[model samples]
Target: MQIRVSIFLKEKIQNPNGHFVLQTSGPVPYGFEVPGLIRYFNAKGQEVRRTRFPSGGNYTSALRQGSFDLSGDRVTILGTNMYNTPSSQEMDPSTTSNSTRKQKQADTTPNPLATEELNLLAKLMGGMEVQKILNVDAGFKVNLLALEQEEEGM
Candidate 1:
């Protein structure tokens, strides 16, 4: 079986309801800083696989999708979007280096989201077998298999 995941970044704004909300004004040109660990586990609650190395997942506009292969009746994928961590991974000076240090800067900018605060979404899937395909287009991006760059041909 095949699985796919897509991610995007949006800004949070208050809609005059005194509540903070995420809004997508239009197309975002920059890649999102999604550095962290991506793990795939089968129905038994054991790690079936994970990225060979931690990901420098700077989600780009490219195809906006990550694909993989798996076979199972059920699977639970845990995407640990590591942000504000104590140590930094091999990252490009452009993608996320500055995004984290700044506060939610402005409503016009799409800031990193700490899910515990609210909504959650990042395509994840796990099963007996996994092979990541990080087909990219213009900027930095990765899939479940992304270690450094992406396999555009995959």
Candidate 2:
């Protein structure tokens, strides 16, 4: 499944206006190169983004927090962070960073999971906790172009 959010500029736009066109760092589509996983068009009526995620490919992506802003004739998709495969974590920069010596020092606030009870308590902290108290989808937020579409009555 693919979702798109686009903003139409009052004036014609150049490709430079496009944000996050494609990436190898975030979630990539099944059997597709990251460079082509997403396509961006800055033309007026062509919509801004086209992301592909073919179904039945055992492909699933985790969504990160996002927001949107809609104006008279424009929409802005704040950003998106979709998940790649679980086994592919080694290829993710963010994941790699977490293991960095520097990151480990900052979060050195030892995961309070040392004690069995705190370990259980950690399950309750969710997003605020580096490790979840529970995987309650606490930090997940999806922002779509619903407002812009609503104006179109669809």
User: Tens digit of lDDT per residue, candidate 1, span 17-127?
Assistant: 344444333223334434355779999999998775554343334224322322111111223233322233322222333354343233235334443122212333312
- Number of clashes found in candidate 1: 0
Once fitted onto the true fold, the runs of candidate 2 whose alpha carbons sit more than 4 angstroms away are 1-31, 34-105, 118-154
Backbone clashes per model, in order? 0, 4
lDDT per residue as tens, model 2, 79-108:
222222223543343454424535434644
Clashing pairs in 2: 122-133, 123-133, 123-134, 124-133
Could you list the CA RMSD of all candidates, in the order they appear? Answer: 25.1, 19.4
